[model samples]
Target: MSLRDAWDRFTASQAELEADDEQLEARRRGTQPVGRCHARSRATVSGVIRAVTFAPAAAGPALVAELYDGSGSLDLVWLGRLEIPGIEPGRRLVAEGMITSADFGRTHATMFNPEYRLLAPDSAEATP
Candidate 1:
């Protein structure tokens, strides 16, 4: 690699680095980009889980995970679920569900109770 390329790589922000990695992995897995998914359509997205949040509601508890696929991020909400095995931050997985906009005017994408499969750690990476 050129010196300039090396310097750019070294100086890239954590989010940028992660986005690049997630995008590459998504392509390798042949999954659709989260950014390209539209509302009311079914999509399968592959990405690394960035964050997990739990919120208690009157009906039941909700577990929400933020998945980033480099192009964009999607919030996966599992209503009435306290927790699920292998659903955590930094883990890679593929999730499929109907796309919906969390806000009016279609800003952010969210999927409720998506079917998901946790991917094994990459051969070059250590198990989280």
Candidate 2:
């Protein structure tokens, strides 16, 4: 890498670097950034699964995953499911569903039982 590129990388914060990488991946996959998605609108977003949590609710078991796509994170919730095959941290995928902000205009946005496709592990074949 060039000296200027190295300098920029060294000066950038960890979050900035991660955001840049996520944005690049989103662009390459032609998926919408999670931060740009509006409430109550249907959107297709691509990102890496950061965390997965299994919480038992009154209705049923819920699997919630935090998907970060550089710009922001979206919570993917699957009701009545304890686990899903290939749903884990560090996996990349594209999900589509109606966006909802349960916190009333707060930073939290969620998609319930979104239609998703798991991507390959490498950069190659990452596009759908």
Candidate topping TM-score: 2
Candidate 2 C-alpha lDDT tens digits along 6-125? 999899999899999999999888889998999899999999999999978878889999999999999999989999999999999999999997763235899989999898988626
Candidate 2, superposed: residue stretches over 4 Å from native? 1-7, 103-107, 124-128
- Candidates in order have lDDT scores of 0.86, 0.90
Clashes of 2: 0
Clashing pairs in 1: none
Residue pairs with clashing backbones, model 2: none
Q: What is the TM-score of each candidate against the true structure?
A: 0.82, 0.87
Model 1, runs deviating above 4 Å? 1-11, 103-107, 123-128
Tell me the tens digit of each residue's lDDT in model 1 across 1-128. 89998898899999888888888888888889998999899999999898998978778889989999999999998999999988999888889999997763224799989998888776423234
